[model samples]
Target chain A: MPFVNIRITNEGATTEQKQRLIKGVTDLLADVLGKNPKTTFVIIDEVDTDNWGIGGESVTEIRKK
Target chain B: MPFVNIRITNEGATTEQKQRLIKGVTDLLADVLGKNPKTTFVIIDEVDTDNWGIGGESVTEIRKK
Candidate 1:
């Protein structure tokens, strides 16, 4: 079984988009690594910008520039 | 640095609870794996029951039993 996680800034993505990501990642692993889609788990996390940090600065602060 | 993700069914977890999970996971990794808490990423995913599946059935469906 393979578990894949996709973390993205909570920017108002529609449900369809999340489903596509799940499908895409699952298909990719199945194609490249011979993984079974049935046993694969895809989780999408929509993190708040304030909760996501890069270079010691949160994404919320970085976006103010 | 370690990226740890915890997925749980969306069942009305408070903000404090989520923060506690983050802290608990970070400390656990630091204690057990010698990982740096500063750079450790703890992501908590609250998945909708309809989106979470098990044995070809979604959690929502399974909970009906």
Candidate 2:
């Protein structure tokens, strides 16, 4: 089965929201990847804002500005 | 950042080997993907033997006589 993993800064999400996101993504992968729901594996990492960036902008910098 | 994920039937590995595997792959991702070692996240799924197959051979069937 294809594996799916996601990493995002924990900047804008509450704990409940993060848990829901994990569940949703894991369910989606099980359906899309043709794997059993129990067999599907998803890992999400909540990173620090300073450690993540896009388009040359650190997450902390973008959030601040 | 590019994400990396791997899933394998844990038919052939000991517990220690699996731990080493996670570490090895995570370190490799840091070097190859240019992410911080602490920031890189990895997930491994050990699937049931009957639930996984390759080249039309179920893992358990192949392992069996």
Candidate 3:
């Protein structure tokens, strides 16, 4: 079983978008790694900007500049 | 750097609980994998019952039965 996790900023991603991401990632893994979709799990996480850090700074502070 | 993502059901997890999870996971990685805590990233994602699937059924449906 292959478990995939996608993390993105909470930018109001629609359910349809999430579905597409899940499907696309699953398909890609199936194509590349020969993984089975039946046992594949894709979880999408929407994180707050303040919580995401990059290069010693939070995304919130970075985006403010 | 180790990126740890913990996915759990959205069962009203408090901030302190999440923080503990983050710290614990970070420490575990450092102790076991020798990963650096400063560069390590721990992300906790709380998923809805409807979004989680198992045995071809969503967690919500499974719970209802």
Candidate 3, which CAPRI tier? Answer: incorrect
In the range B1-65, model 1's lDDT, one tens digit per residue, is 89987889998999999999999999999999999999999888689765564433445655889
Best by TM-score: 1
Candidate scoring better on DockQ of 1 and 3: 3
Query: What tens-digit string does per-residue lDDT give for candidate 2 at A1-65?
Result: 43456575654555665466456545544443444666556566778888878769897887787
The chain B TM-scores of all candidates, as shown, are 0.88, 0.71, 0.89
Q: Candidate 1 or 2, higher DockQ? A: 1
Give the TM-score ranking, best first.
1, 3, 2
Model 2 TM-score relative to the real fold: 0.46
lDDT of 3 by residue, B1-65 (tens): 98887889897999999989999999999999899899999988789765564434445655889
- Please write out the lDDT profile of model 1 over residues A1-65, one tens digit for every residue: 78876778998877566656667777888899998878887666678999999999999999999
TM-score for chain A as predicted in candidate 3 = 0.90
Please tell me what DockQ candidate 3 reaches.
Answer: 0.15
